[model samples]
Target: MLEQVSLFVHSMWELLVSKHSEGLYNSVCLAVLLVLPLLLLLLSVCLCCQGCCGRTCCCSSCRRQQHNRARRKKHDDLWISSQPQPIMMESLTLSV
Candidate 1:
């Protein structure tokens, strides 16, 4: 029984081989082989971007907030230093 099944499978393989060079079968096989590697590469790139980019993105946002806070502090200090003295202003007005 198994021998008969084997013979049938051999005949089927031979028929497929004879017809495979005709056109469409060869093209379909070629397309699948070519696209498989490209699909795998794209999947790896997506996973790497998700891992490496996510961590760096968080750190960058944190650093930006710290930088903005420091800039605001510097501006506030300069603004306070430039203001007029209250007693000097009153004495000047009385003198005038």
Candidate 2:
């Protein structure tokens, strides 16, 4: 009867220890699975950040103002150099 008791106790102890070790291993695996993707995403952002926003020619407000001025100049030149001025048509269209 004592032997049986000892065996039962030993079997229960083994089962508890095995469950504890298995839980620890599973936690480690889950942590790695969750953390690996975040680490990879961070690494990708760090590597590609320069390519996205580093070398655009639109750097300053002054450059933008100059570009807008140039664009307006081109549009004005096309309109002004056309065959008829718009003012003449406006005067002809209305005679109240």
Candidate 3:
């Protein structure tokens, strides 16, 4: 069954590629011509902005660092809050 399925797929691929090679080639060329300049422009814009942020060349990296710092701070705050308070325990013992 697997062999049959593989053979079927291969035959279909061969039929489409061999029969429509000219049309497929033309469409691929046209798509490349249309998309190449836009891709280049996007890359240029990214390169231009890469150095705009102070102390960091890449914007995404700076943002990631800030996010990580904030997350660590939050985790540290939670850990500190979860620990038992010595002063509160001493006060309770004195009241008792």
Best by lDDT: 1
Model with the higher TM-score, candidate 1 or 3? 1
Ten-residue region with minimum lDDT total, candidate 1: 87-96
**Model 2 Cα lDDT, one tens digit per residue, 1-96:** 999999999997786666668898866776687699999999999879877866565769868878899999977774445476456665566558
List the candidate 3 regions with Cα displacement exceeding 4 Å.
Answer: 1-22, 54-96
Q: Backbone clashes in each candidate structure, one number apiece? A: 0, 0, 0
Every candidate's lDDT: 0.80, 0.77, 0.76
Residue-by-residue lDDT tens digits, candidate 3, 3-51 = 9999999997786566567697766766687699999999988877875
Per-candidate TM-scores read 0.37, 0.32, 0.34
| Model 2 spans with C-alpha error above 4 angstroms | 1-22, 54-96
Please state every model's RMSD to the true fold in angstroms: 13.5, 15.8, 15.2
Q: Which scores better on lDDT, 1 or 2? A: 1
Error of 1 at 36 (Å): 0.4
In model 1, the clashing pairs are: none
C-alpha RMSD of candidate 3: 15.2
